[model samples]
Target chain A: MMDILSEMLGYAFLVRALVVGALVSACAALLGVSLVLKRYSMIGDGLSHVGFGSLALATALHAAPLAVAIPVVIAAAFLLLRLSQSSKIKGDAAIALISTGSLAVGVVIISRTSGMNTDVCNYLFGSILAMNRIDVYLSVALAVTVLFLFILFYNKLFAITFDETFAKATGVKTGVYNMVVAFLTAITIVVGMRMMGAMLISSLIVFPALTSMRVFRKFKSVTVCSVFVSLACFFVGVVISYVYATPTGASIVIINIFAFLLFWLVRVLMTKRVAVKKPGLVLLMPLLLLAACGKSETAALPEGSAAQAAFVLEYPSQRGEAPAQAWLRQADTQGEADAATPVIEIKEKMFITQINDIYLNAGDYIGKTIKLEGIFRLEQYEGRQYRYVLRYGPGCCGNDGNAGFEVSWQPRTPAGAAPSQKAYPKQDDWVRALGTLQTYEEDGYPYVYLVLSSLSVLDTRGAEFVTQ
Target chain B: MEKDRPKDPQGIPSEPLILCKNLSLGYDGHIVLRDFDLRICAGDYCCVIGENGCGKTTLVRGLLGLISPIRGTIAFGAKIRRTEIGYLSQQEAAKQDFPAGVYEIVLSGGIGAMGLRPFYSRGEKQKAEAALMRLGMAGFRNRCFRELSGGQKRRVLIARALCAAKKLLVLDEPSAGLDPLAREEVYRLLKDVNRETGMTIVMISHDIAAVEKYATVVVTLGKEINAVGVGGEKK
Candidate 1:
């Protein structure tokens, strides 16, 4: 492994890849925190698509991608800024429209042109393993320029981001600053496109910021943490990709996600333990009492004390009828004694619901009965988990929007786990679940949650919950 | 308002510092202001004011040669070199997330003055630093523009504008968002520059309160020129 690594590192292309990757990662990381804070993570993704169109146009014209991509992307960025300023469309919608439209134009243009088999796929997805010396030089120069510009205009930029109206009043050229930011974002995206690809570039712009948010509070600290996390993830990802012969971009993204999960888990566990020991833990005693009513006294209470184990789901049941009860009947035999127990159910095919104040004992609920119904999203390798959202909805089936949440199952596998359901549900697939609730410590938080024992896919039309 | 005039070898009062007659400003074909006549004698502090979007900015754009007037001729006095017009646009907030320092931003002000010069020189550096010091921003010369508070940033921008101005200064909304104290400081700085150096200062501001305190002459606009005053009194 050492010999192979040494040989790989010795190659100019490999060295270039490392340098360019580091530079782009560092620059993106600096801007990523602000993007996430502003909830504009998708902007990077959109710009990447714009960069793709520019690259295609450049290739077709037999021009350097940097020369062509920079101006085009900058123009698109300005256009996007202009469009966002208009009240006719919301910012995200504008971004989506431009992103898709530009990419489509790029695809059509590429198909029409001949002899330039530029492997646009690599730019779309990323190809760090194939980086060359020119790529490194360009990336480094752009990164340095970005850093220099950012530092020079740091105060002006900060004022703009924090409050544009206020900044404008203070004699800061808010419009010019905004234009500069858009221009810089374009530069970073163009440079990074070849390594991260359009699809995953936003992840590079988001994950590091999220990880840093877990550890840092001040804006300066957030930026520092973001750069550190991004560089570390990229380096580790490159090594792993080399060792395993996986796609470099995908490997890096996966590593970032893993880091995010690790941070999230640790935070959760720490918060949970702290909450348990705090005075507030006593307030939860009543819920525990209710949960303990059915279970044995010494049945090894989960993270939540027995007194806090009771489940208090605030599901939006129509006319006070629980949707879970209806789904529970479908999971069990027709005459099961407890099948008649009141469970939450949705009478309307499409409606929003909020689940709050839910209490369960992590240990005792591990294999206990649970019936949940909502949209289901399954992660690869992880078995079917019940996904529900806390959201507001319009009459019956209209305009359902939600905050994101997911529930897991336990016993590692229930008594009758069938072949994991294929046909991964689409964006909004209505789902019902009959599962045993389980509790585990992710990071440091003790979450008492349900694990799906059985699940049924409901008709898709009623799936109105939109996740944030 | 002509005073003592220095003569060139073949001098003719060196022409009016700035001459505009029947100037018509507009966008596309729609006219905003027309048949407007104005002149700035050397070293005059001219303040232009109007209701929001009532062609104040358009006039500034015209003065800076950024926009063309539809039906007018604008002639600069021999002493009024085009490079002498130092324009400080309304404080545009920098993207705080950007990683740039104050010194670099101040340096950019020199871009106009350099006029395609390939590189910065030691003289330019000295000039930039002197400008910063003049604005009392020497201590913050190395600070990142984003890290500075609103007041500091405004001062730095003022410093930047000064760095580029050799004879004439034009500012847009120099005190739009500052607190009372910062606004006063800005006015004081403007006054000091005008008093000590006799630099021409032209500015547009919505703060009517500062008219009596700072403006040498105020030009108020409406469908036409509403009033022309000196020290807040109708002339």
Candidate 2:
């Protein structure tokens, strides 16, 4: 298990996901407390739906998903707040009205346009690997802003949450603070949507709060526990997704659900005992265990960087032997007599040696459809951009050679131009790409590349540096 | 116009702390209490007794400036601001479901005085501590609010109210769920605070017997608000 984990940690994309995921999770938990107490938990659910609709619109228009979705979702959040406040619409009805309506419009646009493409899937489910630079910078900035605003208004939020009437009578601007909560919630939803996905983002807000409430009876304790629980859940969930190849959003939510049940059972057991004065000690025992998983991940993360850097540097510099193809290819074909499928689905065990073979024997592999799953990389060398689906393999310099091929998207029509990189998966996404193998001559150097027919991110992760 | 006001029987202070003239209060456009006139003087222990739906809480809300009067004006005395007026409302659901400690709840009463400040100052913390001590709830400072019994929760909430009671305090159904022993303790505490601090108090209660026992001034709410002082003429 440690071997697989150490290998997975070498990738830069996973690290970025954990950092941003932790921040977003903490913010959601803090706001979730007040929202749950105020009976506004569904507002998160509503806003996430609004987020999905905006992401769909962004995809259709070929705009940056984060940029377009943030403003639209924020406007929708305020609108939902207003609608919920009014007497006619009440609470859940208002949310249901707007959420279903926006979802419908998004569905129509998607069906009429690209029709459930990879970008759309990334928003629907979460894809940490799908986050680009803008997504990362904006998420961190807004998460910090949300955290600062929360700290600035902590007492006011607590006061209003516990008793709004009293807070108002005591001169707290309850309405304005309510708006602040809504505004913070909107930011959290939009940023968290990238990691948790629109369908499951609100779970990030709801689960941790409800879980903490089960054991910690005080607001401060509940709040503190909620943060830890959220962070722990995200950490464990990401690891689980990495090892088991489950959807990241779904994995996090499952861990949250599991934590809530554990806390609930502990509460019930302690209540039966009647002698346990401090349940915090007993409850936090399991919480600490979950956090320890995160600790182990962080400790294990730095070990494989040296091996990965060597592999990356070695792969692009080495030359593939041109004459080893003729006899090796006929023998390789005879050995795999039943491998007549249109596409060769590369398995994890065969990932390294197979890609190495393709690089050395580019002519024999041309016109063959190969399905490969690895990290989608955009490398810049000599002022030129090259895209590849790659994983590390053992080379002369430890695990220093990248085992993958450069891939280019095929044009949709004969006369039409190929879509932009934004239309494909983002940088360092764990993608499953199917393409026809081909060779391109660049600067008098024969290079193996693939003309991609389809590309989409996978929640599954294999060994980052393979020896096979 | 000032000379026309009735004199107090105990001669504490003749100046009214909160004077509401022809006040109409309710939610939305509908009026629950209309054309009600009342005056509470400094150092007076005023007890308001009325049936359910008589707008006793509404009147309390109006006095605290939580709701605007539909037809008339409410005038506060020169020294009193709404921020100094401690308010314990009848909102129970949020309090029951809220996960807070007794001390945290009490400390939040200083929220009104924490203008532009993110947290309570040292003086405010001391004030909250003093309020808890005054109500004899210092022992329950670390107790979770939801873990407390009905009477204990009421006492803690009253202690919270005292933290913000600089000059005047208003409570709605503070002793509603208490047993006779707890009820008497609450009443005696209020009587002691009223006598010692000279802070004006307006409490809404269904306990007419307790009201007559401790109140320096009693107001009966029907269609109109009628006030009579202890051994004094109706005001």
Candidate 3:
């Protein structure tokens, strides 16, 4: 271990990772106790998904990913918190909804502009090796902020976490404390997301508290143990990940699980000796066993049917839009089929497979007029209307992938007279669209779409869903 | 029951610590208990008894200001701020495996008194320590809370509440899961605390025998609210 540590610390990136890892680990562990006890353990998961979406957006825009992702994820955390507080939405359900939706948004952004860049994978699976000096600095600063705030409100957090109702009665603003926890968790997730990946960042927040709880029963002891365990596991996991060439996020998560198992074994041994003293532990062990089995449920909730049916970018999902080329066509009998202009006609059999290629290699198709036969979808999202000409493709897991290219619909001749909602075909209408392939940017992320010269409803609808 | 207490000359109460007039309480737009007019005064050992789902717990919540009244007004006395009222909810109110020491839990009672100061004052610490000693929980100060017996946990919670409260302590089902001996011990502790501190207590309990034996006032609620007392005032 000494040899490995000396050699590993020689690399600047590894050193950066170690510093940030130790700091973030301690921060996550401190906040994790409150989150786990409050039954908001999955807030970490939810905030990470929101982080993924913002990172994708930042990358596509060529903006600083962390600079853009931090605020966005914080807002998302607040949103998830408020949603969970509502009587209509259950906490887990609220977490599931926001996390999956953000995941879908991320996928749509990746599918449109950058087709699964390795940077995206690092965010998904963690890459401590990729840390830069700036990331280390940011992580250090943010981690310090989190730790400072947590310490400053330690007693209040304890009061609320132990019993929110009681704490509220005593004059501690439960809402403010809860928001503080949420805000701190958001910062921790964003800073940690770079190294741990969105898929595995939640483990850093959950594993330590849980492991400490297995053997230690006092809150202060459990918290101190959690922070210590998190730091120790993080370093060990980093070393193992480097030595074994495994994903850093997975390695850390596995180490945490191992620690939890070891502590659980010790607890069981202690239980046998102290049999009559701890009935709650012995009686609740089965229930805890069920929970342990359920812990493997990492985020990756099924995409909603709306997202599944129309996985289209340029749909803006909600970052407002820029006014682009507009031509609402009844029918363009004369297509833009000049000798210089290339026209690619999509084959009916290969339509599902070909759209994927077009989206993936957008540089090749830009400025070319493409004619395709597919469904016309008019979507109303967050008070903004978007039009798409698309078809369904094979989904990973369930409804993970879909092919929908946004068709920019603006009539240039009608000067400021945007196409009325009635002018477009109804949602899910089968139509043949001929338009020039194009890309537009919003929030720095480029989105591929079609500028239609001709869009008319078709009498015959092609295959709606396809495996090809 | 204590026989040497002085009864108020008037049958009707005045200058109540907590006054509820036509108060309607519910959650998520569903009214569980409504039209509750109650007045809890100082130095009253009042026990609220009712069937399950009759809003016994809801009344406690309303009194604690955890949930606002849907229709009516719930007022506190001139000297009492909402934060000064210490509340001990039902057993399940706190997580069973909460990783806290007996002293840490008791010390947390000072959280309400700490408005903006992050750390507890020396005086507050002394108060917590005194409350712990008074409750005979000084020996369990360093012990883990989850390892304590149900009755012991109750005593620790009461001690913590004492640290927060200057005049009022609200308890919900303090004797819920205790054995007969433990139950008697809890009642005796409460009686002693009430007699010694002269602090007003509003406790929700199902033990009619204990209520008759210990409580100075009996406030029954189910179909209606009736408050009658020996040394305490009637409502």
Tell me, by TM-score, which candidate is best.
Answer: 2
Candidates in descending DockQ order: 2, 3, 1
Residue B7 lDDT in candidate 2: 44
What interface RMSD does every candidate have?
9.1, 1.3, 1.1
Number of colliding residue pairs in model 1: 52
Off by over 4 Å in 3: A1-3, A129-132, A272-468, B1-14, B231-233
What would the per-residue lDDT of candidate 3 be over residues B1-235, giving only the tens digit for each residue?
Answer: 3543423457344368888999889987788777878887777788999898888888889888888889899988886887787888785557776788888889999899899799999999899999899778899998988888877888888788888887788999888667888778878877887777767888999999989888887888878887778555466
lDDT of candidate 2 over A1-468, digit per residue (tens):
466556555544456667889999999999999898888999999999888888888888989877888888888888888887789778799999989898888888888997765446657777554355556788889999999999899988898899888888877778888989999999999989867888899998899899989888888888888888898888888876765456789999998988889888888987899887787785465457666765675565544344345545643422343223343334334424534656766656436545644554455568888888788888877766678898875443344566787777752222222455535556876677777787666676666677776666654444566644
TM-score of each: 0.50, 0.76, 0.69
Residue-level lDDT tens digits of model 1 in B133-209: 87678998766566687777877778767766777888888886678887888887887787667787889988787
DockQ of each: 0.03, 0.65, 0.53
The candidate 1 chain A region of ten consecutive residues with least summed lDDT is A348-357
TM-score of chain A of each: 0.56, 0.67, 0.60
TM-score of candidate 3 relative to the true fold: 0.69
Better candidate by lDDT, 1 or 3: 3
Instruction: Calculate each model's fnat, 2 decimals.
Output: 0.00, 0.73, 0.88
Name the best candidate (by DockQ): 2
Alpha carbon lDDT of residue A45, candidate 3?
Answer: 94
For candidate 2, write residues B1-235 as lDDT tens digits.
0112234677545788888898889899799988878888888888888899888888898888788888898999887877887888776636456789989899999888787689889998998899888777889999889878877787878888888788888999788788888888889888888777777889998888888788888888888789887766687
- Give the 10-residue window scoring lowest on summed lDDT in candidate 3 chain A: A296-305
